[model samples]
Target: MKDSQPELLHLDSDEMTGYPNSPLPVLIYRQVLDTSNAEERADSFEAMFKRHGWPPAWRYHLYDFDHFHSTAHEALGIFRGQARARLGGPHGQETVLKAGDVLVLPAGVGHASVEADDDFCMVGAYPPGQEPEIERGDPAQLAAAQSRVATVALPENAPVGGPLAALWE
Candidate 1:
């Protein structure tokens, strides 16, 4: 194991590559999926994954009244708020994240915050690896736009096999 990485990584992913860029790719927005009337929308995230039969990965949602953002390799920001998105950038674009707002973020999208109320929170998931954030394209007006970045974790209970298992074999 490399001395730079967390020890748990050895037990988790097959290969943990080091990131080589700065100002990582991240996605920022307001809340989109909630439980009030957006229950189905939230469920669709899982359904979409299940229908595709993709491997499980990092998925989490916080009910913080403060702020947060998506850190997946590729994240989607949906609008759950009543208003529309204000901040506009090439990368961390803001939108009135609603219940069903489908955000199609490719790997390396960067953002800073995705705010929702304590009532319902924004949920996000991603496979292993780092999702880099793109700085807000504008520097004059929206300097307050924070850089959005989050590192995705390994899938839950991924069995040891292949290259990861071969290390021992």
Candidate 2:
């Protein structure tokens, strides 16, 4: 595992859209895990997230269509392959994610996979007691989604641990 600090990136919301992206920035932690062995890489992420209070919930690829979650924050650990994903909305920022990377997304932030390799895989998790509900970018649902997102509680621990947790505060 890498001990260096992670590179942080934030994607602010475009108010015109229904996606109520949070004030918290979209976190990107690069090479935080060892990806040489597939099974071990996955285990490390599960262990880290669970150890820090965000229990590992699923393993899969990101959705291809634009969507967001107003119910809880999400932590995704890329365990295999790589992909290009968009954030905020359809026209939002595009980024590449590879193995050993972790993405911490605040509630209501939009995300969609533009393209990914055949082997691409990720482990997703959320804060203890928090569950995710999918919300497509629909203007009609904006008000309700915003209301829910506003009331959603923050996680007590960062998924990756260390100083990176301070970004949420």
The whole-model lDDT of each prediction reads 0.32, 0.85
Global CA lDDT of candidate 1, please? 0.32
Error of 2 at 70 (Å): 0.2
Clashing pairs in 2: none
Against the true structure, what is each candidate's TM-score?
A: 0.37, 0.92
Per-residue lDDT of 156 in model 1? 32
Best by lDDT: 2
> Lowest summed lDDT over 10 consecutive residues: which window, candidate 2?
3-12
- Model 1: per-residue Cα lDDT over 1-169, one tens digit each: 0111111111110111212112322223223234455555546555543333222343444222212222334334232333233221222235444554433332222233355544433335444454433332333312223223223432331111112212211
Give the Å shift of residue 153 in candidate 2: 1.1
